[model samples]
Target chain A: MAAPAILITAFVVIGGMATALAQSLGLFPLVGPPSLTVAAYAAQASDLPVGIGLSLAIAAASTVVACLVGFTAALVIVQGRWCGKLVAALGTLTVPVPHIVGAASVSLLLADSGLLARLFNAGGSWPELVGGPWWIGVVAEYGWKESAFVALVVTGTLATRAVSYDETAALLGAGRLSRLRHVLLPLSLPTLTVSATIIFVYSLGSYEVAWLLGRAYPEPLPVMALRLFNAATLTARPEAAAVAIVTTLLSFGAVAAALAYLRRSTLWR
Target chain B: MIPAVRVEGLSKSFPGTGAPVLDDVNLTVEARSCTALLGPSGAGKSTLLRAISGLERPDAGRVLVGGQDMAGVGPEHRGMAMVQQRPLLFPHLNVLDNVAFAGTVRGVAKRAARADAAGFLELVQLAGFGPRPVAALSGGQAQRVAIARALAARPAVLLLDEPFSALDPELRSVMHDLLAQLRRSVNPTVLMVTHDRSEAAAVAEKIALFSGGRMLQHDSVERMYSRPVSLEASRLMGGANEIPGTVRNGCHHSALGALRLPGDTTWPPGPGILLVRQESIEVGPGNGPGLHATVSGLRVLGPRRLVSVDAAGVLLRAEIPWGRALAAGDTVTLSIPTSALAVVDDPDTAHTFPGAEKRPQITVQGLATLASIDN
Candidate 1:
């Protein structure tokens, strides 16, 4: 029974990748005889580097911020206090909101003429956060959505055996800061790494959030790929496929590195 | 010297429970001495330990260390260490680092802390186990490491919660000997909680008996065994053959017949329970002058035989040498010496005499054999 599902998933995923590879190598021509060439990859050499750099910067920044806030939230939730329950409930509520919707909401909150600027009466004086040179709104959307995911996963890791270990540490003369440094942080590392890698890969490949809140020039890789795929000129399709393949490779690299680190962590046992 | 640890009027209760788990508990541990908190499960012995360690805050009480009140003190600042039933060594650290943790938290240099931890490991007979992962250790070895880790802190008070209860019988004996030897050199004020009376007797100078969240008695181990405060306390310390009777004119009258009381008997004439150790009962042929009983059971236990007898509908237990060769249905005369009798006023056991209602039979044959093996 499982074989059918596995075969179908493998066929769709590998078939899609094969189609994209063929297109990127100049085959599957829409208006001419199919042929093989590296011109599609070579065409975007100048623009591809900028897109990749921007994509990596946004993903890395978003992942770091998400992990810090999410890990703190997890600690609070596992403490089993009233305010901790409230924070946990808010995180649960935030997790289900679509990224595109979160991007729209963030734009309404942080745009120069948006609600925050109106409430503060600092219109025209508010920092350029949405569609600005920095892509603050795009990073904020990804961070807000993915932080909840990280918090939920980390809370699970702590719920199992953290209490007994914490008590033992306390009895062994560890203060609050010492317990966190020695016990909580090391115990939570493997889970935090896995969650951060997921956030990085998701932010790198997601197009809708960046298109909704990003600038037209110097776009993130996903936004650049979408623009090229939708261009009136038919030849830009192969360049879009090349960008998508590069994004996939980067995500794979990040996941592999995280797994290697997890294998070496003492707490992984 | 001031008592190393003192607790006064400690009381705690959980939500939805009408009774407190620890009720007005007061205890003191002399400096450089070991006291065992002996009780059955759910008797709040472990709770008292946690309260003294500052892991649980009592609703009402005060804990003092070295004659100083610890009102606002935290566990880390109280200069106390605890060993739990499970080793609970941190999985993220090796044995050496886990042992050195308290030193690191106190801001000791890493090299010095490790050196001190190594010395402690040697003390616990795990000299070369410093660099091994905690996961690789057996149950006994892990528990030894836990003891070493707790000692590395050099605490003024050491609290252990049934630390050896998880080991095999042989390992448990080894740990008891190791602990006794360590006490001579490290000599921290130790309060160990265990349900096993023999373990307490082996390792503790004083024993505090607890039941139903109330402290029954606290005295030296020898006194606690010889003169238990009540019949329940006597049974807890392995006292057998409790005979309910009445005291009258320097003699006790019961189903076993009137017997001369000890000259030091001070009880005014009334109903009481007489306690006799199983080893104190002497058996002879049916021709002797004593209460006549028929042997109902004979169990050959290594060097001795446990003989069960029925005397005029009263059941009694006696231990004799294996050479007696008595069999079931043999008539014998049992004599309990007057000096060996300890009368107790236990209201709970007043109507629990062998012939009154139904005697609560205790199956301690296996326990006796285990105790003998330990010796």
Candidate 2:
């Protein structure tokens, strides 16, 4: 019974990737006869390096921020008080808001003439957060949104798995900081890694947030791919597929690394 | 010297649970002495231990360690360590690191802490097992490691919350022996909680009895067995026979006829319950100047047989040696010395038995039979 569903999912995922690979290799084209060449990849090689680096930097920044904030939020949520409930409610509220909506809100709220700049009356000295060289707006949007996802997932693991050992550590004379370092971090490492991987991959491949918030000069992989895919030149389509393929490969590499690290963790075992 | 541990009027109740988990409990343990909180499950024994360890805050009263108040002290600062029922060893640490955790957390050098931990492992008979991961341990080995870990802290008070209840019978006995060795070598003031009466009596110099969130009695192990203060306490302490009667003129009058109360008893003239330890009641075939009864049931428990007898409709069970073969329907005379009797009054029936209510003649053989199932 499960075989059919598994097969269908495999076909959809693998078939889509195969089609993209074919297009990137110049074996399939929308406006010309089929042929094979590395022209599409070699054409964007210079831009490809910049795009991959930008995408990696953004995803790395977002994942680190999300994990740290989410881990702290998870600790608070597991404490089980009014404050915990408030944090939990806020996380729950954040998770369902679409990232596109989140990006729009972030752009509006952090732009030079946006809400905070107007409210604070500091329009002239505003930080240039949106459409800035630092890509601060894109990273912040991903961090804020994905932290809630990470928090909820990690809180579930901590509430059930870490509590008993946490108490045991306390009884063993581990103070607050020591308990956090020894018990909470080790116990929650696998969950944290898994959630962080999801956030990283999502940030790497998502285009709408970066496109809406990032400066046009050195775009992230997803934004550059979408731009090329929609350009007037038909030859740009293969370049777009090449960028997408690189993004997918990077995600798969990240997931494989995370799984390798988790497999060696004593707690994960 | 001040007691090593003192709990004064500690009370705790969970929100929305009207019945308190602990109610007006007070207890003390002398320096370097062991005390057991013996009671049924949910009797608040473990809760009291947690309160003393500072893992739990009581709604009323407080805990003192070595005559110092423990209010606002966290478990980490309490100079106390606890071994939970399931041997909750740190999964990320190997056995040596787990046992060395307390010292390492206190800034002891890792090598020094581990060397000290190896000695503790030896004390618990797990010396060579230090390199093994906690997950690789057997149930008994894991518990031994937990005990070693707690002891490596060199705590002022060691709290054990049914630490051996989860192990098999043979492993539990081994743990008990290790505990005895620890008491002799370390001699730390210890407070342990257990529902098994024998476990408490074997490990603790003093035993406190609790039921329904209230402490019923605290006494030495010998006195707790021979002189429980209430019928509830008597049953908890493993006494099987309860003869409902009234006390007047220092004599208890029941279906078995008037009997003299123990000289130490100071109960006033009132309806009372007479409790007799089955081990204290003697049964023989020869006639005697005691209650003449007939055996209604017999059970073999190792080298002893639990003989149930009915003396003029007052049912009683006696533990007798298995030398002479006894069977159901056999006639025997049962004698219980006045020194072996403990009479306690029921609060509701303090004044009367309600319109000349006759003593119920139901056999307590079922109670003895149920008690046997625990073994």
What overall lDDT goes with each candidate model? 0.86, 0.88
In terms of docking quality, model 1 is high
DockQ score for model 2: 0.73
Weakest 10 consecutive residues of candidate 2 chain B by summed lDDT: B350-359
What ranges in model 2 sit over 4 Å off?
A: B1-3, B245-271, B286-290, B300-303, B347-375
Clashing pairs in 1: none
The alpha-carbon deviation from the true structure for residue A74 of candidate 2, after best TM-score superposition, in angstroms, is 0.4
Mind giving the per-residue lDDT tens digits that candidate 1 earns over B103-218? 99889999999999999999999999999999999999999999999999888888999999999989999999999999888889999999999899999999999987889889
TM-score of chain B of 2: 0.89
Over all chains combined, what TM-score does candidate 2 have?
Answer: 0.93
Give the C-alpha miss distance for residue B23 in model 2, angstroms.
1.4
Provide TM-scores for the models. 0.91, 0.93
Index of the highest-lDDT prediction: 2
Worst 10 residues of 1 chain B by lDDT: B366-375
Q: How far is candidate 1 from the true structure (C-alpha RMSD, Å)?
A: 5.7
